[model samples]
Target: MFSICLIGVIPLGTIVYILFLFFDNPSYQTAIHIFARKKCEQRANKNAPYIASYLSCFLYEVIKKNDIVDIPVSDTSINYSGYAIRKNSVIYRFITPVADMPDVDEYNLQKILQNTVIGQLNHYGITGLSSVYQDTTTIVPSVYIDRILYSEEKHLVAVDVLYICTSKDLLYYQNAVRESNNKNKAERTVYDDEV
Candidate 1:
């Protein structure tokens, strides 16, 4: 009897999980739309490295125009993967995988940005700008652009770029990071820097 009950519950649990995946939260969907426009851009036909450099420069301009401190650094790789600094400490990184997600469309990408990063930061009252790279495989393609908010102290201290991953996976990874950060906060006490 117990074994039969367990088997029945397994199917019921799976149904619930599937429903949650399909029925996304509305705020998250809206946020992705808001950021989508600025996140997709076309890349130039130069070598991958050159294209990457161009993106960094483009992102720098956006950051600077928004009054974010720019930390200059040498060029790294290209093709949707690179990093930049702000005020010498905060770092932002971007990456695109060789392959795309199975179910993701333009709409999904837009939703991810709006709901996940931009919406969350806006809630915290941090504002800044963003640039998007599209079809980086080709030179001279459409790029997405937008403005975002990043606080001096709380914005993107560090980021690890990922490619070809689902938006859900990315959010789950971020949630884990948030949880870890929360745990760390309790382990340390405040200290005066002057001493």
Candidate 2:
């Protein structure tokens, strides 16, 4: 009798679970959407390095009206409000107020800018490219979007993206020199030194 009752309960539980899975469940839908967005971000990150080299080559001409003359470098921390523009092999960094997020079309434009920066760095013969999304906020920029495809339930926020481009060869050579001399390993830091 106990075994039969247990079997009956298992089927009932399975049936309920199936119903929840198949039915329109808001919580489940939200979870799925969040998971998908994360996965997409991960895939983008993985492909970033491979494309950075190609993108950096065209960054200067791609980013329009860049007149800044120096690369913004921070010895202590990353700069969030500034953008780095590459002209030929020289990179100019300038600090400005936050730029607004582009609309869906502008988002495409942003992708072009991103690809351009990555490619320009690669053209400099730098390797090991990485980009990180540091912050997302709902503060809208001055730019306008021409069309809206789908409305988001939550206000869409602009993201702060940080890109790192460095040379593995130079790093390895420096490390080897330090090791041969039996000196303490130098602390690795990102410095946007003037080119």
Q: How many backbone clashes does candidate 1 have?
A: 28
* TM-score of candidate 1 against the unseen true structure: 0.24
Q: Which pairs clash inside model 2? A: 52-118, 55-119, 55-120, 56-118, 56-119, 56-120, 57-119, 57-120, 70-93, 71-93
Best by TM-score: 2
Tens digits of per-residue lDDT for model 1, 1-195: 999999999999999998787658777668776566334321111233443454455433333333222322223311244433222211235432222232333333333443443333334322222222223342211122222222344322122322212233234444544665686678777779845
Mark the 10 consecutive residues where model 1 has the least summed lDDT: 138-147
lDDT of each: 0.37, 0.36
Q: What is the C-alpha RMSD of each candidate to the true structure, in Å?
A: 19.3, 19.5
Predicted structure 2, TM vs. truth: 0.26
